[model samples]
Target: MAFGRRRFLAVLSTTAAVLGLASPSAERAAAATVCPLALSVSAQVSPPGGSPYTVCSGVVPSFDGTPLDVDVSLPQDSSGPLPLMVMLNGWGHDKTDFESTTPAGNGANTYHWNNAWFTGKGFAVLNFTSRGFHRSCGKDPATGYTYATDPACAGRADWTHLADRRWEVHDTQFLAGLLVDAGVAAPDKVVTTGDSYGGGQSWLLALSQDKVMTPDGTSVPWTSPKGVPLHLAAAVPQYAWTDLAQALIDNGRGSDGLSGAPGDGPHEDPVGVAKESYLDGLYALGTEYGQYAADDPTADIPGWHARITAGEPYGKDPLINQIVRQLADYRSPYDMPVPPASVRIPVLSIQGTTDPLFPAVHTAQMVNRLQAAAPGYPVWTFYGDLGHSYADNPHQVWAAANDEANDWLDAVLAGSQPTTARTTLSTTACMPGQTNATLTADRFSRLANGSWTFTGSTGAVTTSSIPDGTEAAAVDPIANSGCRTTPAQSDRGVASWVFDPPSPGIITGSPVVHVTATPQGADAELAARLFDIDPASGTQTLITRSVYRVTGSPGNVQPLAFELWPAGWQLQSGHRLRLELTQSDAPTWRPDNETSSLTLSPPVLTVPVRTS
Candidate 1:
């Protein structure tokens, strides 16, 4: 039932085995051994029950000689040869995991939705699993998580490196070429898409200019698992990260509107928050020169990049830090080292507003670079108020149209016109009782607050367990890192909003807080936190928290301001919705230091709820 290069794995192996080609002396010796495996391809049914798709699975070469299992799904009813696509997964994940979760629910993979939307109109999808993260076999011999997790082998990682995006870009190019060789797909029509790690891979594939070197000595090139030049056509990454190095640096200390809470008071441990606080500077570079050379060692201000030179920093870093530098350069379809003066294909992208990993600056910078390289690349950005996760976010909005986001792929990739809206929405907090049982059990608890009091299925879902080390890093507002812990004053002095326990379980998404303050022009800060607001110990232990800042400047007269961000967690049955309004958050935002005293009114942070 499968078509495309993925099928070639089966066809070639079968032919080889049938002809006794397993080994030159197999027939003259013992016996040819073939591993028994089940590989099948399927599709989404529309209008309650639509056409079934044909798909196939097989173990193929990943970034290395070691094989990776892939499931290539295609439309059975297409009238012509199909377009090609390679889908990837994120961190601590595998291929099947991608198939199970997405921005869209219903067990339909969002990437799969791309397949459905495009395949039904005539496109082909090849889902790839890299070496270590998922079921994909093999290993990353070089940098990134691999090096840190296995440092002794750090410098040795060459073609096997999965930390940099080139390894993945090669994975897509090789897989696409194989599909073309099989005659099931057109090599030139292949496109790539993914989220988080996958999404970052998407951009890496798109901007991959060539096999370049870095000052740090990391390696990247269009090579086979054996080091060969690979190719591609288009790409789309969602909620991705770029300039993570800069992010680590700037997030260390915040500036003006941008802040990264490193840790708590001077005595606080920098362990979890240290390197990450520098994202502000990283994002600043992304905002200012994301399209340029922030990571390039040759750049004037190599620490962070902004504007113009940001359009493409291809060759600059190849001579210095190869690992960190190589992480910056990726080869696109054009076979060039930069995004190219133009792209032969259109590109589409999505980003979450409250994504904890990367900044919105990355998305904005990407569009600028794409436009500079090629006019009308046909880009799309979807905003969500969630952190790095794709599965569940308390801030997720239930959009009837968001469910149909794949239609864009259908229209552009397979040539189908899907009628769906592509806009951002706020999470809708669940009411006291209803059918869609707001409580999503597993993913419900780990958010703004460290944990929530729950009932019913106490242990039905594992993700519902508490995340250790949950405390806001203390911030020195003066030093300008806006990240901080919830002050006792904020609990009693600031305006507070509360909700009662629900009879039925509940799940909350991103929150939108609206606050009214007296004495206009106040620097109002709204923080949506999930805590035992009425703490049994009298002191509320802070959990995961979301904070935002706004300068009230409406006609020099401040009205109620609405600040939206992700609660990105769940509100268990007994947990209540807590919204606090105050002058500042320690390190994440600027403190309101105005002489005018501000009072909080109508301070309620709305929770997003979806019921059955």
Candidate 2:
């Protein structure tokens, strides 16, 4: 991530020749008509034997006059306005995630999509550091690096709003508008694509359409500093969340009464369970690599993490619930008003079936809502086993998904129909030496054409009073890079059911579970896991799971119904589908700290299967 100075005069001379300008002065005069802000050329990057591209690195003032670090890469041969691709990074990462050749945070390799690659594809790539990360008005407390120079942030740190529409999303729109005004990018051919945190921003940008939300909470036409109108042509959001609350702190009570299924309206109250490990990991990364406005009372990042980490009595604190809900709802695209069809654009959402953080369900919910609101809007989704967790075929899945996304973008820019299917699902390679397979359907639900149900009452299963050690240890989304084994049943807190399919098939959707539970304390939680038990080796591979929080009188019987995280895996004839109902799945999920238990009746498990 070196930004060595390049010969600016010589580069400008060369750019003039490429642009057919008579001299450097002519090129400067031509650019002066469109570009009002000063730009500095930091470095020139060329992919091995490829045409060199200029990387102009500088700062752009956002809506509130906050300086945002930005890098604009332009190909030498491109003439007139070029199609733009705004490359974004994940949580706790900066623009370097798309610049450097080396791997950065979260195993993100630049070879996948870099400045040179996009420039080679005839696109002008814009990569910028999000606010409170690296150089964009950020101060890493751990390293004593400061970029907070705004007058409002003079006495304190300028914290990240976690991609709030009014801040991070607006910053992107404003930057894109600048590029459009500078005559560097086409006004109608701009696309936003990113992973994880940036993925969330990508979703927001697409939803915002031709308008941007102002600091005063009003919507205005997206325009540049020079008054040039702009809009997003397409968006490719990978491993993103439609609803922040449902993704991070889920209550498992969806509006449709089907637990994890896409609800009919905005997410309701009763703040959900905390995903302790993921939340803590992100907060730590922010503090270590980025910056946090820890002392700012208006900042919610510090306060939200602290309150959730305090543990237990979750629903009892009314103020804490308000903080959590307000923070999540404002940042979630699911809660936003549906955009009109006139401004809506094409979207190709890519998600990981194995991603524990933002699973396929998030994208599914978004696609469902979008289609419901604006029918035939050219929205497509590709679900594969490539994300935060272990992927059976990482390289293969990654390549295919990215290739599909690029093809979709190409088609959009060309004003043609894409050849890729509307909905594509990739199954994990369960058997030794077997390659992952993909299936196509018109809709997400069609991928799972059939189901297998196990119903009947057995005996009540009680949970352990302790939270940590007594809980079953399953897949660590961060640590387990390779396929790992999980226990089918634990001694104290886990209730298990084994179902043997009559024939071989593929399970391709979320599994719904129903049970009647009586809480030993005022509040209780249940973690459900679905595993594929190999009949020959007697090994269990964790497929998908989710956690549900139960709140009621101590002895009241609550009929708990929820869907496990969606997954796609091939099941053998002799292999068994084991459903484990446990009180806690530690590290991955924060268990209730109270010394309480949940007594459950025999559960009914319904798993979706694909015959063809």
Candidate 3:
């Protein structure tokens, strides 16, 4: 299996050669023509019956005169007059992050083929990079490149190359337009979807048909694609940053939750908005051209210390330093807020359970804004275990999520009337037959062959019991009875179960503890939290949340089972993952009894494992 270097660089340089298509003006002439993508397609099946399909690369003209590379894939069928789904990539990225193009040899992006099922279900899938990304013709000789000084980055228009701004948006809008231009899809009814940054764009396209405000707050097109629409027929946006201002706020360094100094008030001022560290680095590099050697200076750049601590050698680059500070002040929600009432189309919003950026909370914020603005309309939301883009991003969910979003869109695009349920979760959909992935209390995560761990509990413990082949050094959280010993305790609410780290490199799914307190009596619920020893502080980053709330009861010997969300935390090198148990996660979740001493048996912690 060779890495895709030719397709990457080839498309990066020459587009017409790869996609076998003409330039923009030429495309316009061919637009109304019915040259509906003369292409071949196929599929590759994963073990146990999971099949993904793909298509050869296609072409279009994105950007002003630059060539844009297109990767279109479909299901394993030659369905006719298929519904189309055209998607674009995010910053510093291309179509690969979404889906692969080919399974064997050097092929196209998969998202094209990944959507084959969607295509099989009757839809044509499309994904591509703008002229700036590989094979997409546009290139900014300044900021994006290491040796170029991007002067454009220093003004009101945001110094991104025209490729970044116009070309990318053009990439998506153009694809959808091409279908109609070439008579592939009807303009009025399109079901578009994406997660994270791409989700932002899908919302943009659904709205692209709407006549609304431009990025500059000026009103534009209502349907014919002017500066992106403010509407769509059915749009699914998952784990997306609701507002740019909130994104900068959530992305601010440190978990203190201050967004900015309290004086930073509203996000009306872009310059005074926000600034992340990288933004500053770009400025410094741009200001001090020919002064240093580096690729992109990300946060982990080792050379930063050598340059910064080496005295004020780079002191004259304060303007460069202000780049980060400037970015922090940005408040462009919906990429550029158009008022949710402005968004009259059906919307399906999904969120990730543990996405650090563009978190579930951000999605909630969007719902709040939209509901307040437009009281009666269709909106569906889902929170799942997946993260950002399924394939293309370092932090996005690609496959598991794409299907989830697509499944819902399938219902909407089919014109199913939705109930007025403000929030609809996906627990019932694809709910794998609940598998009991249990491990003895002494072990970290569950492994095959009944090997929970090498230790077990010595007495009455709440974690897991000292079962066969359990750890010898298993910890007992029951002994840790006081709140003072718990950093997360508020009024006697904290539970801890300790275990050894699994053989290094083993990442475990969320842990579910099935415990039975012989006597069940509680008004409060049990909040399950996953924590690990904080190497330095010797505590834990207690990832706590509610499992279920049980009404305080007065009974004897009742079975109680709590399923904590399957988590993905590592019992890292030199550290162990701990399960903190509590009647409730305080302040946020209040436990009724502080002194309810009940014997806990069946002390089993069920952990999901990538590699047992």
Candidate 4:
């Protein structure tokens, strides 16, 4: 049954009273009669053995008049002004990602749960095709994905701004406002969420509080067309990035040291090493499944990919530095202003410990900032083995992560304290029948009670050959981007060290590595990998890893300190801890390509450990 504006509102009011639910006020009902944007109801779908819900799909003009295809699903059995859940899609994906019933792989499918599932929970879910993707005034001829020509988007080719707060983020706020004005969503009870790309957007929305940037770059309070104020009650950003620049191309600069904790130094002026595999994969997906702004330097996917992968003179190139600065300033939540305590939205951030694209450290950094800026704000983080990479226990972790997020959302909406811990870290169990255990703490740093350090030194290693191992292949951005294990191999151009723990323990935080190195060339790059080596068979399970890039005068010795991606790994008694440093971790990170060598003094490895 197709319900027009008046019929929908009438049904809502009548059903609400019949069901003894709160009915919309007469003022709200009257205001619903006049919607600012023209909305057309296409179909009313009823899931098998479930209540019917209306699905409305149409083009909505964004901040700059860019037409965005939006889908709104509302439960027919529910009353008006229901809690709103604005679901977003990942990069190169469309609104259908959340609407479709197909399960997303990689143990990160919670965000892909269909719209009906949420509407069944009394949530008015809104999904939209982000700017520059299919149905959002862009077309990919290869995939035959094209939308009906809308005059408003006549000259708007390749308009994706890469989730710029002023663009894609504003689009979501604008659409939510319309729903509020139409009495379809509760103005104060809205939540934003999504995975990967959408996760990043959700984070920015939470940081935005109730403010939005106008098309002209002016910041203003978020309000509906009818003047109803809008605010996000909560945000769940799964496997998201706080800093797009650091995520895609990372400089080793980590968060400022947590009080009394050893942290990486301040952000120095340096262009980071590009994650070639992910960058290539994303660029291809954008061009194939969506649209890319090839000519627009700021939004040009191809240009950015080429410049990043070109390699060398990294910190010296002004254009590359400009690109990094622009990405961080325009696309990173790290640069956004934290909301004051009065308006700070509760955030439940779920990240993957082994996700090479955006690791647990990303969320940890954001959490630290939030804690410092808005003390005691309701921000919880859950890290597991999931996301764009492979997981050792996909089903178990996926279910657990989803449960945590759901409970968090429920608690925040009910204005009750969440029973869940402030931080939860789940380790990837590598052995058969091994329990994938969890560790909880009040803060990220507190996850590890103490640490174990191994001191060592190695001969000169050169970036002449690709590292040999399954770990490298498994973590490759394109080939086998997931967690995997194989027999540990000590090969040429690889610096290796092994440590035998006297007792069973858990490595629970980011591993810090400090090396004094003398470069053979103008620049040097290193990929560090930590593994769990089976005592008997020597089988190795990849725990976590990171890539570091640096430029210096040849033969000049400099102290290099960096942290690997944060992880939670249980080490059995008698099992060994192995650390390997190589020149290239191909397909995961772009190889430095130059035949440069590094002469390093004894390196120090500090691992945060907890023994119960």
**Better structure of 3 and 4 per TM-score:** 4
Candidate 2 Cα lDDT to native? 0.71
- Tell me the lDDT of model 1 at 599: 42
lDDT of 3 by residue, 1-612 (tens): 001012232231132324333345434433332234453222221211233333436455442333445766544334434577665444444554444323221222233223434544556667665333333432323334421332322212222231221324444555665555554555655566554456666555554435433333354454333332222467776455555433432211111111111111232221111222322333343333211223423221224333332322122355324323323222223443434554567776656544433435455445545554565546656554434311112112334344445555666667776532334322111111212122222111222222233222535443221122211112221112111123322222234556775653323323445555543433223445555554545644433232333333544544444433323333445655566555433222222322343445534665544444
Model 3 weakest 10-residue run by lDDT: 252-261
Residue-wise C-alpha lDDT for candidate 4, range 1-612, written one tens digit per residue: 000000111222233345443324423433343322575554455444344566666888875678888878777646778999998988877775566321222234553345756777788889888888877866746456564454667665437788888888988998899888777899999899887889999998988868888756688999987788887999998789998888887766765233333564443346667788778777776765566665776666667778888877675577686677668777888877877777888999988887778878889888888787777978999888777755433677777877777887788899999988999888876564345798888888887878887887455444443456545665554345444677766655578888776678888878888887777865667778888888677687778888777677887888888888888788887788788887777777777756777776667888888888
Residue 514, model 4, lDDT: 84
Per-model TM values vs. the true structure: 0.48, 0.88, 0.48, 0.88
- Clash tally for model 2: 0
* CA displacement after TM-score superposition, residue 68 of candidate 3 (Å): 1.2
lDDT of each: 0.39, 0.71, 0.40, 0.73
- Candidate 1, residues 100-212: lDDT per residue as tens digits? 21223223224234433444446667776654332343232222233234333233222223334444555566666566655566645667776666777677666654343
Cα lDDT over the full model 3: 0.40
User: Which stretch of 10 consecutive residues in model 4 shows the poorest summed lDDT?
Assistant: 1-10
True-vs-predicted CA distance for residue 108, candidate 2, Å: 7.3
**Residues 379-492, candidate 2, lDDT per residue (tens digit)?**
899988766655543666766777777788888888899888999988887555345789998888888778888874568878754654532545766665546575444445
**Most accurate candidate by lDDT:** 4
A best-first ranking of the candidates according to their lDDT comes to 4, 2, 3, 1
